[model samples]
Target: MQARTVFITGASRGIGAALARGLAADGHRVALAARDGDALVELAAETGGLAVPLDVTDGAALPAAVAAAEAALGPIEVLINNAGVSGSAPLARTDDALWARTLAVNLEAPFRLCRAVVPGMVERGFGRVIFIASNAGLTGYAYTSAYCASKHGVIGLCRALAVELARSGVTVNAICPGFVDTPMAQAAVDTIARTTGRDPAQARQALERLSPQRRLIEPAEVVHAVRSLLPEAARGINGHALALDGGQTLY
Candidate 1:
């Protein structure tokens, strides 16, 4: 693939950072966005990409961030909405604030980003949008009502944009991964350990067992999926919530 301007949210660490490095290695001019300004600057220096410190939940900041990225790198041809928040709570305990925040970060932010980027892509006759969703979007979990609802909303938005942009040379898709070996996953493990009186390792293993492969997914796997969807060769792969889980949602 030829070098294109790529913008990734949550690019400071974990899957988003991994994707930024992978795409940069593939010769794309990248614009990295996240709340971690220090990490973003470091990664930007390392990858030779622009760092735009952004909090995705701040709706007012989205346009300026996109403009800055476009000014520095170029019109964003690839958008990776990887910034997300996960909250695990039973339906009864899931308060309004958690529900609102989960939806804001995981769903509404992506929608806003897509709105900000897709028009230019349409005019340029090319674009790719990838949502870093979760398997919770595909299947219900015991104590993840808000998380599931947010991810499900993301998939819905992805499909809607994919269809709307189908003829305009842009493709929108969601990559729903199961529990991955990221800081977020580690936090979940820590939470389980704190609440259930299990060792951290045991808590982690419980997550791993969610996938039949019995292991947490590596960030590289998600990077590969995003890379696959970005190229012209994968043009037909639109409007689909591509599951990155190891058959966790196969049923």
Candidate 2:
């Protein structure tokens, strides 16, 4: 693959960090992003990439960040919307504020970021857009109303945007991962303990059963899915919610 600059959100940890490291070694320039400046800086240095620390939910910061990146590197040939909020609550318990916050972080933030950079991608006639979504997006998960809804919205956004930009040579797609071995996933496991008083190992086992593989997914597995989008040949695979859940959704 030709060396291209990639701008990724939520590069501080989890699959985002793995993707950054993987892409950098593949001869691609990566722009590290997250709410934490310190974390972003360390991730960038680790990969010899650029650090553009900012919250994805902030609309005002996006254009400036994109411009700065374009000036420092070239126009972003790849954009990864990986930042998201996981809010778990019963459907009846979900308040308007919780719903709004979920949309802001998981849906609206990526929507705005895509709007900011897609124009340039269309002009350049080359770009790759990947959304790091969740299996909750494809199906319902108990007590995670906000999370499931936000991720479902993300998939909708990707599908529509893919069609809109089909002729522009920019591909938009979402990767839905199931119970990945990340801090976020760990928090979900902790939720099991709190809800039913299960031990840590038992709680983890609950999540493991959600996937047919009966184990938490590795970060590298999800990273590999993101890298698949960078190739020229993968342009045909747009507007899809790819399941990287170890066949969890087969049931």
Clashes of each: 0, 0
lDDT of every predicted structure (CA atoms): 0.92, 0.90
Please give the distance, in angstroms, between residue 20's alpha carbon in candidate 2 and its true position after superposition: 1.1
Residue 74 alpha-carbon offset, candidate 2, angstroms? 1.2
Q: Which parts of model 2 are misplaced by more than 4 Å?
A: none
Count of clashing pairs, candidate 1: 0
Candidate 1 lDDT for residue 64: 100
Off by over 4 Å in 1: none
Which lDDT tens digits does candidate 2 get at residues 41-101? 9988899999997888889999999888888888899999999888788889989999899
For each candidate in turn, give its C-alpha RMSD to the true structure in angstroms: 0.9, 1.0
